[model samples]
Target: MSKPKDYTLLVIDDELQVRRFTEVSLSPHGYEVHSAESGREGIELGTKLNPDAIILDLGLPDMDGLDVLSSLKSWYQGPIIVLSVRDDEDSIVAALDSGAHDYIRKPFHLGELLARLRLALRNNQANQTSPVYTSGNLSVDLSSRRVTVGEREIKLTVTEFELLKVLIRHRGKVLTHNQILTEVWGPKSVEHIQYLRVYVGHLRQKLEADINKPRLILTEPGVGYRLQNLDLLKEGMTASEAALIAEKVD
Candidate 1:
């Protein structure tokens, strides 16, 4: 589907005042805002309309916020930032685990929420599928959702695409299992390290010349994973010598 000219947002919260306030805050910034008074309505809107981002409140009349987040994650690729009055550790952790990209407790400054939205948009640019970059033999198009490795287009699942995006975002930064899990799968996913291992292995099989000992997606044993183009990091090269690596993901 062709993306709309403006960034579109879906705000899901049972509180009328909160939903209205968020809509007011975001609309002026050139975002097309949509609102839902309950979790069920929000889910329907999210599934039917491919909005650029979502702002969901955990305490909904129809369902728990974490459940809403998890259900949406199976289908959406764009960011979903959670808003709620509950700030308990478990609640926060669950929201993240359910696939929320970011969170803000109730009584948050509208400005701060706006800033977080901007960051999510900045990050979503990678998922745009535009013809973006090439490293070695891989060609990535963020805007078109097309990838070509050695002149052949590669097919990837939603989860695989998202996994690839997370690795590319931290290109040189060695992302620990927990950090990667939270960022890619949500905070509640800290214990699912095996899921990470399996997907990383899949990525290696698809991208590496030899899957047994990978090159592009480097594993750090007990630490985490670092993804970098090996040619850009030959011996004696400074970290600064690493080329600006890029990947198209959403």
Candidate 2:
């Protein structure tokens, strides 16, 4: 029942016009807006204020937007929307892949921006309730961005963590190559199935007792992959064998 204006927003942009535009457009609508013209200042402000959300511009005077995003993500846990003139797929994917919740091309429509902000805020709030997910020995804390296996922490790249998160969220359900790709790497990278395979391989290596015979993640045999249900995996068949059985059923 809360409106976006009830929340605080930080805008990291160098262009005075963009900053003013954002302020003028959203201020009357109930948003508590703050602005910074450089990445360094933005990072400092973000760290200090801990706003409900951030709107970041890719082009900045002191540092690249990606750098700022990476730095902020190292500590900040909030919805970050990338607002940039770079509409190229590479830039967009890079931003989203870096940890941005959404990407908006510059010259953006106010309505669309508002809509995306609302959706991101809603998702953020929903995620705040359930931060930790567990499956037997493996545990992932979404809020802390930590993964562990029986008290030992597992190191994972941002991409790998994102991929694992998607799989774990849909445990016991098969997710096709495209579904995983789109969810983790953005829609532009959906055709890059090899990316998914490589990251999955990385996740297996880090989490599995033996990578060759994985006990947790299962390959769908020319289809996709699924995170094994610990209960079912212990009952009778391992996930790998279950996957083989599924292939047979299909």
Candidate 3:
């Protein structure tokens, strides 16, 4: 794909080599690139530059990368691709849940990274139109980051919101535990099935009219979970999540 001309990109990494490599690669391809050597500098540059997108490194010299991600997200809504050497699931999940749009492991291919950057930019532009997704009484305002059921607003933590967003984004589709984990939390967290169970239960208790009989989120036994029958009213939650919700109630 041809690169889009005049698009500004901010690369935030402590390593001089990574910063130089990104600048050299992206500059020739039509991106006006800027570099920052620390989390504080990155945040400041990002705030001042207001780039179209950002490439963030998780392992910063001064502060944790996740903290930078969170702080930047509070003000910057642009697509942020986390570029990091921390390939572990927990780190990836934390970054994603904190609002990183994409996570790319370090030692990445320039071609693949460029492709991801383009895709992120394209998606961000498409999403600006404001799409609202609904299932029964539950509604998710993707643009506003607001969720509600009937007349009541549902309050969710950042992680819970991201988790719910993933499920709602793929409503009516059964996403395996691994798929959902990778989307919301990151790749390494696929084995943390227990975390999924807990969050699903929390969602049920908040959204379902009757927690014991949830009408939205459905379980696929050992497979995964999905929001069932978006265009139609479903009867109840799947057994596992329902069971967990029941436990919460009791």
Candidate 4:
């Protein structure tokens, strides 16, 4: 009849307000929270604390978030959710490709943030034994952590890769916006559905033959999305994206 114990988390953000707010926010959830003001300090603390997960701000006072991300990837082996206000495609792609487990845009809800954090922890543990994930034309070799589209390698940002993997793992099921957000983003953020729209837009743009009539990334209107069967592609000529890709054919 006792309350469940809280997990440990390391939060790395240069902004004092953000750091303090996050620490207080997570404290009630039974999480043993640690704070760092710099990427360097974060990495060192991450090694020492061995926390369940890490929340890292991309823009740091001492170093770039991406640079710190690279450093963290070099040593740490846990869930890392990249925090940033930058919503551009290039920045999101760069962070995910570098090894961030997930990403969070700033000005978010505390409850959603906690959800995202916990989901990251759960996924990190799940990936330890078996890493390969499959859905439609996409197959992610988790052990090798590689993603391929019909035998052709498709580069995905870390967050993209995670999103694809989760969607694949739960194919055919109707994952609500919040469900996808929680699963892909983390336990900390189950309600930031806008983030889902942006990331899903990116995934379809990258993976579908045609982004307009997305065959691979199927939308559920007001709900979440899904991966269509691979056969759907060969049977259809809808390649809005193929034309988009063709632009680079030269």
- Report the C-alpha lDDT of model 4 over 1-250, residue by residue, as the tens digit: 8466568888999889998998787788778889999989998898888888889898888889899889888988877787788877567656765767666678766655665565456545545545565546677786677878787998889898889877765533234566678777787887688888899889888777778877666665444564544532233323543333222111
lDDT of 2 by residue, 1-250 (tens): 7555688999999999999998998887678999999999999999999998999999999999999999999999888989999987677667766777666677877765665566456556645566686667888998799999998999888888888889765555445676788888888997898878988999989998889777678775555775764544445444454454444223
Per-residue lDDT tens digits for candidate 1, residues 93-135, read 5665465776667887766566556656654563354346555
lDDT of 3 by residue, 1-250 (tens): 8566668999999999999999999898779999999999999999999999999998899999999999999999788989899877667656766777666777877765775566466556544544787667778887788999889999988988898888766544445677788888888998899998999999888887888876677665555675653333223234443344323223
Give the better candidate number (2 or 4) by TM-score.
Answer: 2
Alpha-carbon lDDT of model 4: 0.70
CA lDDT, candidate 4, residue 204: 84
Q: Which scores greater on lDDT, model 1 or model 2?
A: 2
> Cα deviation in Å at residue 202, candidate 2?
24
Tell me the TM-score of each prediction against the true structure.
0.55, 0.56, 0.56, 0.54
**Residues forming the 10-long window of minimal summed lDDT in candidate 1:** 241-250
Off by over 4 Å in 4: 1-5, 129-250
- Candidate lDDT (C-alpha), each: 0.72, 0.78, 0.76, 0.70
Number of clashing pairs per prediction, in order: 12, 1, 3, 20
Q: By summed lDDT, which 10 consecutive residues of candidate 4 come out lowest? A: 241-250
Best by lDDT: 2
